[model samples]
Target: PADGRPIVELRGAGKSYGNVRALHGVDLQVFPSQVTCVLGDNGAGKSTLIKIISGLHQHSEGEFLVDGRPVRFTTPRQALDRGIATVYQDLATVPLMPVWRNFFLGSEMTRGPWPVRRLDIERMKKTADEELRAMGIILDDLEQPIGTLSGGQRQCVAIARAVYFGARVLILDEPTAALGVKQSGVVLKYIAAARDRGLGVIFITHNPHHAYMVGDHFSVLRLGTLELSAARSEIGLEELTNHMAGGAELAALKHELATVRGVDVEELPEEEDLTAPVPASSEGTS
Candidate 1:
């Protein structure tokens, strides 16, 4: 599966909202059994790029490809039809609904004829339990309200739902943003499971540690533009965290601060020495 072409690819993708350009010339590829992470602070065009790929919005420039064929999707259904599914931070589930009900909310199983048609509750419950277990998730009861589950559990439910529905590509938006250490670990485990199940995962997040945990490829975005892109072999945790934390721009600020304090900037303790070229910043003092 890894030897084949990417499930989806974006070539110089760009998006514009009238006079405002939210994204520009961005390239990304999602291959089966690999997690591709898009890391950035807020307003870094993560959402914009997601929209373009998930079919919520169209790319104004460049190409969006599925199975190496360029295409434009007019609606979310179009994207879903192409086996691309996006699971957002706030999962679209009825909080008060039972876990089994939520699992098959829109695509529920049915039985009997039109005169005596009825929901296949037994089959739904059994399938939901089995699916969750397959993803290494264990729920005490499927009858409980979904709202009673923890953030990570809820995220897992959404992921399982997506996987069960035949999604070849899964785009997760900040899946672990609101989770604690243990909760985040749970989510990351399922993400790895999804990757192992041969789904191309695009994990969008601001946390480098979380991204680095399950990511095979990484890309950083700054102020709606790409800062850096690299495969796992070409980068490390320290380097990934550095880019997420502003890289050289942050070094310049620390250098300026040390200079202001009359402390030798060279001894300020950084990956880069004082001689390294750091672009001067007027806002370093402020």
Candidate 2:
């Protein structure tokens, strides 16, 4: 049961891409001041699920709820209008533009009347700096291009921008996949900060460690189906890891790795390091 009420909820959601069933009968809930993590392997319908929640794609079945009311979003704009903002790993910022410009990219403030509209640079820069600082993002220079920042920094800026724009529910898609340990921690802290501000957050990632650190609720998907769902207290890290990797697919992978290394399964090396590194190709999602 939702102790209070969820800011966002999905009931029996499903999506299909032609002949391929991407997500099937998935139910999810997102509450304020908490992170709801959606974890899955590649092609396990993580992308499809996020798309449906963020209004990038319409579910073929089931209903989406916001603030306890059912709603249908035909486009991402509709979702944003409902105060649901999505920050994909590849955030839509122009790398060459200054951080201030990127922060106000599409929604720039303007002064003067017709035929004399000019950007309110001073106000925009001041607000951008203040907002970023409030979100625990300290930048050396607001004039610097966003590309100059690390992956975590850019992710922070995007999150801050979304919050500043009046987002009530924030959906992040694999935000920390490209960052190092320290950088990932920065993003996780800001995520907590967002939750503290009473915004519901949906954290989409393949990293269980990261999820466990910030998430209050967890949902695991495998082969386009929901494998497990529960509060953090209901499951431990080992159980979560096993659910994610100790499944049939991971058993097959273990057999393959042992065979290739010419070792028996019982003689296998430590399973801790066996977690596969997300390849560079997957970096495109970040």
Candidate 1 TM-score to native: 0.89
Would you estimate the TM-scores of all the predictions? 0.89, 0.89
- Tens-place lDDT digits, model 1, residues 1-286: 5477888998898999999999998988899999999999999999999999999999999999999899999999999999999999999999999999999999999999997889999999999999999998999999999999999999999999999999999999999998998888889989999999989999999988788778899999887788899998898777788787775766777767875866676655574532322323211110
Per-model clash counts, in order, read: 0, 1
Worst 10-residue stretch by lDDT in candidate 2? 277-286
Task: Say which candidate scores most in TM-score.
Answer: 2
Q: What TM-score does model 2 achieve against the real structure?
A: 0.89
Tens digits of per-residue lDDT, candidate 2, 136-169, equal 8889899999999999999999999999999999
Which 10 residues in a row give candidate 1 its minimum summed lDDT?
Answer: 277-286
Q: In candidate 1, which residue ranges exceed 4 Å CA deviation? A: 251-286
Instruction: State the C-alpha lDDT per candidate.
Output: 0.88, 0.87
